[model samples]
Target: MIVADLSSRELRRRLSDDGLYLHSGPFICRIQSVLAKVADGLALAYADYPLADADYADFHLRLAAPRLRRWISPQVQFHADVRQPFLPLPQQQAYAMFEWGLNWCVSQHANQYLILHAAVLEKNGRALVLPGHSGAGKSTLCAGLVYGGGWRLLSDELTLIRPADGLIQALPRPVSLKNASIEVIKQLAPGAIFTPTVMDTSKGSVAHAKPPSDSIVRQQECARLAWVAFPRYRAGAALNTQTVSVPQLLMRLAEQAFNYSLHGQDGFSTLLNWAQSAQAFEFEYSDLPQAIAYFEQLASQPHTQLQHEAAPV
Candidate 1:
């Protein structure tokens, strides 16, 4: 059964009792929370995700109010397998805390695959890997592509690369939008659903956009890596893009990887193989529509062989 199949009362009961085993891509997260915001967020954002069995889960997590501070200066704590990794956050931000905490769990423990801090989308069986730092417009462009450009959302935060086959494993979840980008996406896809904007947390006004139902349904499907684009957004800057050499791309991607040092030589080899086979580029743009159009054109092309320039490593 999917999350939508459960009534609000039942959902809350499960959270307050045992837990809700949620299937998100390749991992099963058993979650327990009494916060209304957490329940509401799950109801709206993860309604399409499948329910997992209670026998075993990849991660066990909980968000609950502190004992003494439950009434005064109320805050919520995120518990992961008896360990509280983060300090308490405002009770109003419980849902956002849940989202961030879950990301922490996967990025820290799910080391079976080569995970990168990137946004991934797929089209025509080709996956586009957008690796960028914060405020680099990666999520913004990803949201635009999935909601407005007809691309399928693979993931909005973590990009999982299976080591053996080098194919990207799908982890389609809610796309987190921050500050100004929230409204930008609202205008981009007027019909898209979003959690209520929560103000005054770290990251300045955070919100999450629900992933498309199609993406959630096809969470198990994998896509071949085709393009690695490093996107940067600058106001009033014209679209500028250039091909990047494999070595340069490898070095940059290594920096973006969460556990590149964990797998040692095997990780190096995996990334090297991926970079050698896929095209890489540095893309800079100001306007979202123009950026989307550029990618749409890139997708339509049967073959693209841009000149690669070597840079200082």
Candidate 2:
């Protein structure tokens, strides 16, 4: 059963009692919370994700208001198993806390696959890996491609690469939007669903856009890596693209990878293989529409033509 199958009351009861086992892509997270915001956020943003059996879950998570603090300051705390990794935040940010906490769970513990702090999207069976630092517009560009440009969302925060085949494992979850980009995305995809923006979070006015139903439906499907682009957003700057050499791409990807050193030599070999197989570029843009159009054109080109046209950096 999908999350949408549950009645609001039942969803809340499950969350407040035995916990809700939510299946998204490869992991099943058992979430327990009494917060109304948590239930509402799941109802809207995670409506399409499957409901897993309670027999087992990859991570056991909880969000609850501290007994005395709730009466005074009203704050929410997130727990992963027995550990609380983050300090409490305002009660209004409960849903945002859940999302961020889950991301922490996967990025910190799911080391079976090489995890990169990047967004991955697919089209025509090929994946585009966008690795960027905070404020780099990676998620903004990813949201545009998925909601506005027809690319399938694999993941917005973590790009999981399976070492066995060098293919990307799909982990299509809600894309987080911050501050001004929230309005920008609303303008880009008016019909897209979003959680209510929680103001004054550490990340600055944070919100999450629900992944498309199609992306959720195809969550089991994986994609072969075809391109790697490091995107930067500079207001009013014209679109610029420069080809990244294999060595440069590997070095950059290593920096972005969360568990690169954990895998030791095997990790280096995996990254080297992927860098050589896919074309890499540094992408800079200002306007979302123009950026989307540029990628759309790139997607339509033959592999040979793309290789010939790429200017070495």
lDDT tens digits, residues 1-313, model 2? 9999999999999999999998888999999999999999999999999999998999999999988896887999999999999999999999999999999999999999999999999988788999999999999999999999999999999999888888899999999999999999999999999999999999999999999999999999999898999999999999999999877998999999999999887888889888878889999999999999988987887754133333343
Q: Candidate 1 clashing pairs?
A: none
**CA lDDT of each candidate?**
0.91, 0.93
Q: After superposition, how far is residue 195 of candidate 2 from its true place, in Å?
A: 0.3
1-313: candidate 1 lDDT, tens digit per residue: 9999999999999888899998999999999998899999999999999999988998999999998897898999999988899999999899999999999999999898999999999988888999999999999999999999989999999999888888999999899999999999999899999999999998899999999999999999999988999999999999999999888989998999999999888888889878877899999998998899989988888855544453332
The local distance difference test score of model 1 is: 0.91
